[model samples]
Target: MTTLPAVSQHNPWTTLGAEVRYENNWIRVVENDVINPAGNPGIYGVVHFKGVAIGVLPIDAEGCVHLVGQYRYSLEAYSWEMPEGGGSPSVSPVEEAKRELREETGLLARQWRELLRIHTSNSICDEHGVIYIAWDMDQTESEPEDTEDLIIIRMPFARVVDLVLDGAITDAMTVAAVLKAQLLAERGQLPEDVAKLMLGR
Candidate 1:
């Protein structure tokens, strides 16, 4: 059985004070003095995101999924995963997904569907991530942002699943979306055309 959220909500933690520790174009960090749920006084630092994160898993007609590789500043390493970016909270998540897909791979998907909604690091950050599956695309030249240096690759969707299982792809959104897509295929939950395309490869 599943338990859903109640219509009424209550907050347990009480904040004594809050101060901004840092701010950037994308995120803001705040230090909050609070009384814990257990009645202890402590400080909690939180990273607040300014925009919603968007991720797109674009699979072509031949069952090839597009991946983007780039150097991650925070990790100081190169990561390969689904094409993803951030979108203004004012815009629809699906619209941002389309933009990210187009910017990273220059592919416009004819069909799009959401895959998952997640919070990347809820304990220390308030960042919302939305993952999507896109198919039946038209390919063209990529127009990456000036700050982005990306490498695009097209490979079998199954290979992406292998990478996920092998821990080679650790991006939260990518991991979730790829596994979800596989599960959907296994359970015959996807569209007849999309499922056949994914399972076929």
Candidate 2:
């Protein structure tokens, strides 16, 4: 009988204590006192999110997608992305995605599929998010929040994927969703109609 080496699955960092360094309604920053994976003393600061992030990519029957444009406060730059919003822990992510899509693009989708889950900045923050694909859409008046000054544009799905590849779309969720959508369409993994629309087949 041959003996195999045992692979350890235990966490290497040992947390001795934690303290909240800052907090707000949206996030809490905690500084942790810990012994490092290399057995050295160190501290780690983590930003804990108070809610989940939700994003929706709505594809119309004409093979176009709606993108929302706005200036991001943190980035101090304008961004073009799919409909996105924060989701409360008490609410369903799908429901939240629907609300965001409606508020940002005024489109209601009869069909929705979860596309992906992501952590925006895993090295520093615990901001988890859900991305969705919504089709069979109906247009309505957008109900953007008072704080939102939004611009909506409709473009071919393939063009949007090109924008992502060309570095024009930098929003993490939007980039991930669009690329995933493109791959799905190429692989014939999406619904036949939707895939056809995406690939212009």
Q: Can you write out model 2's per-residue Cα lDDT over 128-156, one digit (the tens) per residue? A: 99999999999999999987999999999
Which numbered prediction scores highest in lDDT against the true structure?
Answer: 2
What candidate 1 gets wrong by more than 4 Å, as runs, is 4-9
Q: Give per-model TM-scores.
A: 0.94, 0.95
- RMSD vs true structure, all candidates: 1.9, 3.8
Per-residue lDDT of model 1, residues 18-78, tens digit only = 9999999999999999999899999999999999999998889899899999999999999
Error of 1 at 84 (Å): 0.3
List where candidate 2 sits over 4 angstroms from the true fold: 1-8
Kindly provide the TM-score of model 1 when superposed on the true structure, using C-alpha atoms: 0.94
Determine the backbone clash count of candidate 1: 0
